[model samples]
Target: MSDKGLFISFEGIDGSGKSTQARLLADHLRDAGRDVILTREPGGSPGAEEIRALVLQGDPDRWSAETEILLFTAARRDHLERTIRPALAAGKVVICDRFADSTRMYQGLSRGDLRGVVDRLHDLMIGVEPDLTILIDMDPTEGLSRALSRKGAEERFEDFGEDLQKAMRAGFLALADEFADRFRVVDGARAVDDVASDVRAVADGFLPKRRV
Candidate 1:
């Protein structure tokens, strides 16, 4: 692992398995003796988790796009203060399931064009992007099927349905060009282990040599 901290984030539309891959990468690096912190947003720290429920658990229309953007940024600020920055300061590899990219897509793509707001808020309050972002790309129809098969209170985002998901997937792909230096697009339609193997390979290339 790098002695200097590494920050990584996993991003994709719902059920693209980014979260699972984030967890697997965390575990894989830990097994090789790297210190890792695995977390997610719209929740990571305690205060952020509270905000997450407010933004993600209610009716799909509970919060307007503008209001939801504020909530997500608020949560991200708390997460950075209480969870991410501290871990990175301690030289831990911080792997987050979703970060500002979700905001860029969810609010900026599906609901409204809030990319400027998202970017400015991030620049103002949460001024750090992940060192690497793994975008798990897959067909939205398949993603929705997989997402709907699961049960969770966090289904508010999924309730937006397949059309939005497809649009969001395209939005994420487009980001590859915008953030080419930090973005890696991986096909997520494969088996879990296969995708994980690919993810591990990517992460290994990004980080320092294994120290175990």
Candidate 2:
């Protein structure tokens, strides 16, 4: 953890409601008069957003697994420089929708054998992990159903189908175990408000109280 502020990241399979939870947490923290920045990846800063469009749009196979990993790392570096790091330096609670964990799961899943490559690249370039990471766990079938209902060009990942999503879910759960110190698993199958409240409480425990 940084000495100045909280860096909380929300991580989960697509449609696990992690994105929504991240947003709600940011809002809740802001309401308590905390300095907060809500951002996301593949694109959080300008350069990252451009990279996001490239990665998330176009045909599903627009980039090969190795190339996709490189692009994601590039965007993440830009995000760390232009957005996340600076905000933390200024003593703001920075809530990121997804971080390197997504890269690990998505890219590693691509080749199954490429996970080592992904980890090595992350260590070589983007070495920082969030101070706290919330992993929203959900049933893949339900998550896929929700994900498909949303219309967007970003449907490239969703097109991978439920089996892949289930595998990803297991991967994410495994990650929570692997990085237990900084990761918390939340059941995303619950009601939104229930999940939101749980998220708020968990984050509140980690954050320092605002000064009068």
Winning model by lDDT: 1
* C-alpha RMSD in Å of predicted model 2 compared with the true structure: 1.1
Taking the tens digit of each residue's C-alpha lDDT, what string does model 2 give over 1-212?
Answer: 66478899999887899999999998999899999999999999999999999988877778888998999999999999999889989999999999999988898774466888999999999888999999999999999999999987798888878887988999999999999999999899999999999999889988976677
Off by over 4 Å in 2: none
Per-model lDDT: 0.91, 0.90
Model 2 — which ten-residue stretch has the worst lDDT? 107-116
Q: Estimate each model's TM-score.
A: 0.96, 0.97
Q: What is the TM-score of candidate 1?
A: 0.96
Clashing pairs in 1: none
* lDDT tens digits by residue: candidate 1, 54-76: 98887989999988889999999
Clashes of each: 0, 0
Candidate 2 accuracy as TM-score: 0.97
